[model samples]
Every structure is written in structure tokens, then in C-alpha cells.
Target: MPKFFNTAGPCQSDIHYTLPTGDRLPQLEKLIAQRNYFVIHAPRQTGKTTAMLTLAQELTASGAYTAVLLSLEVGAVFPHDPGAAERAILDEWKQSIKFRLPENLYPPEWPDTNAGSMIGTLLSNWAKKASRPLVVFLDEIEALSDETLISVLRQLRSGYPNRPQGFPHSLALIGMRDVRDYKIAGGGSQRLNSSSPFNIKVESLTLQNFSLADVKNLYKQHTEATGQIFTPEAIERAFYLTDGQPWLVNAIARQATEVLAPDVATPITVDLINQAKEILIQRQDTHLDSLAERLREDRVKAVMQPILAGQDLPNVPNDDIQYLVDLGLCKIDNGQGLEIANPIYQEVLPRVLSYTTNASMGRIESRWLSDKGELMPMELLEAFLGFWKQHGEPLFKSTPYPEIAPHIVLMAFLHRVVNGGGTIEREYAIGSGRMDICLHYGKVILAMELKVWREGKRDPLDEGLQQLDKYLSGLNLDTGWLVIFDRRPDLLPLSDRTTTEIATSPAGRSIIVIRG
Candidate 1:
């Protein structure tokens, strides 16, 4: 039987393998021939290692070069000791070569010593003895310590001039980040410039998730080997939930094939895919755990707050956004703003961050807004404001993420309101105008746009009006409400403040502005 699961690493020949559907391969192949140092980066499990391995195999099979795959992850464990790390790396190199190439074809002169200098010496000797141009692929390059990483980069730079005559012809560094972002601290406050060390890098390529067609093609592999097949709806559901994430696609398929249907009479359907997704999430598998791990970082929170609040994130550095994208936590939309990459990420984030607090909110069914199937817009806003008045101060104090306290409370309250009856879809991005929250009940749609109250200014009102109008227009609705949290201690409510319906933008819909 063909292997179906590939969670630990790339799929092998006997395993069910899906060809890379990304467009980077042709450019990669071209770069390899030119003997250039390049970088391959992507979020974990997006298949960077698999792509590199496959490319290495293809390059070796073409009779143009002796390609090898090596990993530097082991070096990350001993960040302070470059010597031992280099030894571990050399040992892994030997194992990789033995696994891929025949014993006779393996270079016989490879140095057996674990010394730091031996790394460059061994590669140099092997390249000189090789019959063709040599290519070296270093996977998990980001895991190496600053000293070791710099050592590796400098060795490659030192050997670059020799090229096919004395050293490896080309080299590739594969990792979770681009070379420029590497921060290596050494003896007594000395810092290494990662990009400068590897200045010879010709191109940086990022591997993307599988496409819809690729998901179909992958599923077909299982069907071709076994007699079972995925129904069209099942395939569509898989794409919807996974957004073509390689691991998720394979995992959901494997669940459906092996676990969901033990008999051939049952057809794989959308329901089965949904069941598999829930199981996967509940299992807290490595994929979900890995994605959630970044949420604990302050930088990740800095980028996510605005998206959650439906407000523009000002002064956020470009590097921060790039970091989140590399982690696969967010993606750029229309080159304008960043949004969570997929539903699974969206669902996992809020739950992982607020599980304890949400649970303490006391069963939503017994809470303040449980009487009606869906709370009326103004009523829900008023209740949340009241709850904030009583508990908001404490909640904000307890929150680790103060910038997003209001956002978390609002989401929690809404989640409480719709706990069992409906769903709320949220959309926000760093540097976007505002966060958009759409509460969906069978047919009744309540769209809310949230904005932080700017002290001593009416700009929040104008911003709120503009955002509510946009939300209404996007949902094809005629009217919507904007709720603003006034943080000013001195400002008293306008008891006579009536809800006003006014045209916001010429092309946008009119909005109901509620000032609290």
C-alpha cells in the first residue's frame, strides 16, 4: 500500500506524493545552473524542505551536478558551541548522502574530523574530485546559532571564487526567514550582518501552499492507488477549510479515507471533511500547535491587534509584517492589507488566546443576552457598554494585550451572544481603516465596525461613520451601526444622543452612528 501521511517531512516515492504546483520551480532550476547562492523560505509545513529535496534529486539526475541536501537544525540546539554543531551537521551530511547516493558514487575524500575548518575543507576537496558542478542545499538554515550561521555563510563566501574548479558550484539556504532578518549576537556585543555575510545571494524564493487544482490532483493520487474516491463536494470542502495548506490537505484527506469511511459504500462528502477539520483542531496536532506558538510573541500581538480591532495600525515596521507572513499567520490581500491566511488559523487564534477568559464568562446561554435568538443591534451594543462599565476596568488590567483589550471583550461578548445560535466573521489587517465584524444569523445580518475612541477629538465619529458605511456596502445592506468606545474619563454621555442616519461617502451606503 502507498504511504498517505507526511506530517514529519516530505513524502517519499512509495508515499503518496503531490508535485509542487507553485511557480518558483522554473526560476529555481535556472538559478541552480548559474551556480548562484539562493534562499528558499516559507512557513512550516508549506513544503520548503520537500521542494528543496525534490529539486536536489532532479538536479542530480540531470547529469549536470552532484547535488546534496543538508540540514542545520541540529545546530540550533547548541547555539553557543559552533564546533560541536558543525560536527553534528557533518554527520547529518554523511547520512543524507548515504541515503540518496550509491556508496561507490559518494565522494571518498570527505573529511571525517569535526573541526570547524573541516566543513570548508571537506566540501572543497569533494568538489575538486567531483565529475560535474556541485550543488549544496542547507535546510533549516535559520535554526543555526549566530556564530555557527555566520561561520557557514563566511565559509561559503570564502569559497565562492573557486566555483566549479575548487568548491561547490552553487548553494541554497532553506529556512523560515530570509537571510536579512537573521540576528546573530557574538562575543561582547558584537553583531553580525546576516545579509552582508551572504551578499552573494542571487535570489530569495518562498514556497506557497498548493492550489485548488493541486488539492484535486493530490486527492486523485489516493483514489488511483485505492479504489475509493472523493466526492466533488468533499474536495471542495477540503479546499475551503485548508486553503490548500499542504499538511492540512494531506491530513484531512487521510482522515477521510482511512477513518471516515471504512466501507466503500459511503461516499466522502462535505460533512466528513468538516468532521475531519474539527477532529484535527481538537487533537491539537503539531500543525495547529506550531501555528499557535507565534501568538505568544509580543511582535505577533503588535501586528494582530489592529486587525482584531478593525482599526488602522500606525507605525508598524515592514519587517514585522514580513515576519508574520513568513510564519504563515497572515497574508497580504490585493497588496493593500494583511488578513489571517485561512479559516483554520482564524478559528485557532481566538480560541488559543482567550480560552480561559471565555470559559470564565460563564456559559453564554445563561448570560445577559440569551433571551432572544439574536440580540438587536443597539441592545447588544448597550449591554456590552454596561458590562464594560462594571467589569471593563478589571478586564483591561488583567489582559496581557492592553492594546486589544476592547477588541477581545467585544469578541467575547459577541461570542457569548451567539454561542450556540450563529456565527461572527471578523476581518481586519495591519494599517487598514478599521476592523470589520459581521454577525450572521440564518438571514438577519448585523454588521459592526469598531474603532478606539481618540481622546479630545471627534475624528473617531468620522472614522466610525466611514467604516460602518463600507461594511454595509460590502454586505449589500442598506443600513448598519458604528459603535465607538469613549476612553475619556471626563466625557459624559449625551443623554439625548439620537441615532443619526447620514450618507458617509458619495458612493457608500448611509450608516447609523451610536456614540457611547
Candidate 2:
């Protein structure tokens, strides 16, 4: 059977096109030899499980260590009951060992124990009986929180010193987050600082998304297997859209191969890759949907809200930033500052925020589209003016985040204009203090910049004109619009405030300045 790109669970060599897992973690053997307890963390679906599983299998087959990979997810169900959670985890471990290990390597039976000490006791017994030194990888360690998490970490900490005889020679806690950010929720509400409990860990390593080379190699496997060539542009586009996010990389190729162009002889192109990307975002598949769901989290909002609004950075803590980075929502861009992790996320975030508003915008007539389906910027502007005078306040109130309310409402209105035949691309980041949008329909391209007039700040018209000038230069468009939303408390009603006029940019380009 021909292999396909895999999005769910671990990738199987016989069924999926996968990069070499062992190569991604070259430090595993050294870590095992040194008897280190460590943390392996990454955003979801980044091949952590596949890497650990393969490493465990390779270690066992090498006849040097009896390595096992088991999950702690079951324990999450009994968060408040440490004993019950421990019991569930031990049972899971026993079953996993029974299936994966040879008869001679099976663990000795776990002693019946209360929840608090169950895991420590089980590991101690297993290590005592194992023919060789034992190595264990505990996947989904983040799922077990509160008392269960505390109990499990403490037990592992307690058993750290007695290795190769009383406890496993090496241990790994694998999950979506690094250990530093763990806070025992519910009754135990303190942060799990690295100084105690599982301080035995030597390092907190993270799995990186596929590099550009990794992506090309992965797609090259498909070409080798089935002779369906992925164009160099297609491969590059896949990397740019996904930033090497594992699920997205595979999902794009899978969509292109299996749905968009099933004929193996036809080479996949960048256009088809873009089509696949649009489908993935529109479908809101489980991976992207779950990531969108994280937008509702307070930590996520603290970082994301400002980026969406193009406002200055908020006073968010370092841990919050690290948490979002671990989740793959945003990353620190060199020395500049925090930004959405990639271009695709930059597109998806605002769209997700405006989804409901876009749906509700059906009452607004699509007046901007010409009879020939061309987009008229001035017509769109007039429609927005009318809509803002009538329904903008209510829509603004309905927005989830106050910081980005103006941006979201405008996006929702624009989405109506671009829904069927046009495309709107957005670029906003913290410290930019402006959101830039480019609307494309047929050959007509419109560039727009959105800013806000706060109570004490000067009207942003001059700065906006200069910014729009550079933006238009980049897009090679000689004309654009600059919109400054008046958000001051003393401002007049929307009906009186909404107006547009012409201005010239520093680069001498024509710019339409709108104040509302």
C-alpha cells in the first residue's frame, strides 16, 4: 500500500511519510547513559510521541536498556484523587510493558498501594526485577495535575537517587509544556517551581517543528514512493504557511495529494498548496480548532490581544510568554519582540475572532463588488461608513477582547466584501500601533491601514499616512486608505464622527484618510 501523510498519533513507517525520529533527538542515548531524569516538551502533534516510542524500541532492541514509553493521560481523570490516578497509571504501565517487552523483561507485579506512593513503589519493584537497567518515558505528564501531579512528581523525586537497582536508571516526563510553568490547579494552586519535587531533571528539552530541509525531505519521500512530484515552490509554500508545524505540513500535502490532485502524475504546485491551506483553515480541523480554542485562555489573550490590535506590549509575565511559546501560538522574533508563530497563524487569529461577526454581517449589502466582480475601494468605504453609523457600536460591544474590538469589527465588515471572490491579507504586531490590510479582488488591489485615537494620544493621521506610504510601496500600489478610529470617551456619536478625506503620503502616494 502507498504511504500517506499522517496527522493523528504516531507516524508508522509502513503507512506514513516520516522524517527520521532518532535524528531529531540525538541526545537521548547520552542522557540514558548518564542516568538523567529530564523533561521533553513541545506543542501538540510535533512528533514527540513518535520520537520517544521509536527511541524506546531502538533501546530495547539494542540489548543495553529495557526502555518503555507509557502515558499518564488516564490519571488526569482522577485529578483530585492521587491514589486513584496512581492506580490507573500503574495499570496502564503494566499493560504497556506486557505488550511491548519480551516475557523475560516484563515488570514484577506492582504492590497494592495507596495513591500517593503508588508510582514510586511500582518503579522500585520493576527496577529491582529487571534483567537490565530500566529507562522509562512518561508521556502526557501535563495531563496529571493538582494532587495527582504533585504526588507523581514527588514519588519520582523520591526515587531519583536509587537508580539501576531501586529505581529506573533514567526517566523522562513528556508533555505539551516544560516543567517550569506547571501550576497544580484545584486545591493545590501553587506554581511547581523547578527548585523542588522533580528537580532531579537535568534538562527540559523541546522538539522543534520540521525545518525547511526536513519538510523537503518529508515530501521527497512521497515523490519516491509514488512518483507524485511536489514542486519546489509547493514545498517552500508549505513551509512558509505552516512554519514546519508537523500536523499542518502533513495535512497540506495530504489534502493536495488525496483531494486536490489525486492524479499522481500531475506535479503539485504552490496554487494547489494554497487551496489546501484555505480548506484546512475553513474546515477548522481538530488541530487548528484546538489551537483556536486556546485563544480564549487568559494567558493566550494577554499576548495575542495586543498583537491583534497592533498596540504596545502589555505587562505580561515571562512565564505567560513561555507558556504560549510552548503551545506554539507565538514566538519571540529575534530581538524585535513577540509575534504570532507564523504567517498562517497571523491570518487565522483575526478570522477566528471575527467569525461570528462575519456570519452576522449578512444584512449589509455587498455594494463594493462591481457587476463584473471587481472590488471598488471607495464603494467598500461608503458601505463601511453606512454600516458604522448604524451597527458599529453594537458589534464593537459584542467583541470578545476590548483591545482589538475596532480591528475585529472592521475585519468582520471586510470579510463580507471579500467573502466570495476577494482575499484580505493582514499584518499586525505588537509595537506597530497599526493594523495593515491588503484587499485583493481580480486585478484591483486595495491597501488599508487601521489605527486608533485614544484619549491622550495625538490624532494618528500623520503617522498613519507615512506608514501607509511604506506599505503601499511594498505592495507596489500607488493608492491606499488610512483609517483612524476615534476611541476617546469625549468623542461624538459614530454618525457624526465617521468621515473620509484625501491625503498624500511621504512617498507622494495618494491615500484616503478616514476618521471614525
Q: Which predicted model would earn the best lDDT?
A: 2
Error of 2 at 33 (Å): 0.9
lDDT of 2 by residue, 275-367 (tens): 888788678788888889989887788888988888887788888889889999988879768889887778788888888777766677788
What shift in Å separates residue 335 of candidate 2 from its native position after superposition?
4.4
* lDDT to native, each model: 0.73, 0.87
All candidates: TM-score: 0.81, 0.96
Q: Candidate 1 on 334-397: residue-level lDDT in tens? A: 8756788877777677656665456656643333344555456666656665665655545554
- Judge candidate 2 against the unseen true structure and give its global Cα lDDT, from 0 to 1: 0.87
RMSD of each: 4.7, 1.6
Q: Which 10 consecutive positions of candidate 1 have the poorest summed lDDT?
A: 493-502
Q: Compute the lDDT of residue 2 as modeled in candidate 1.
A: 59
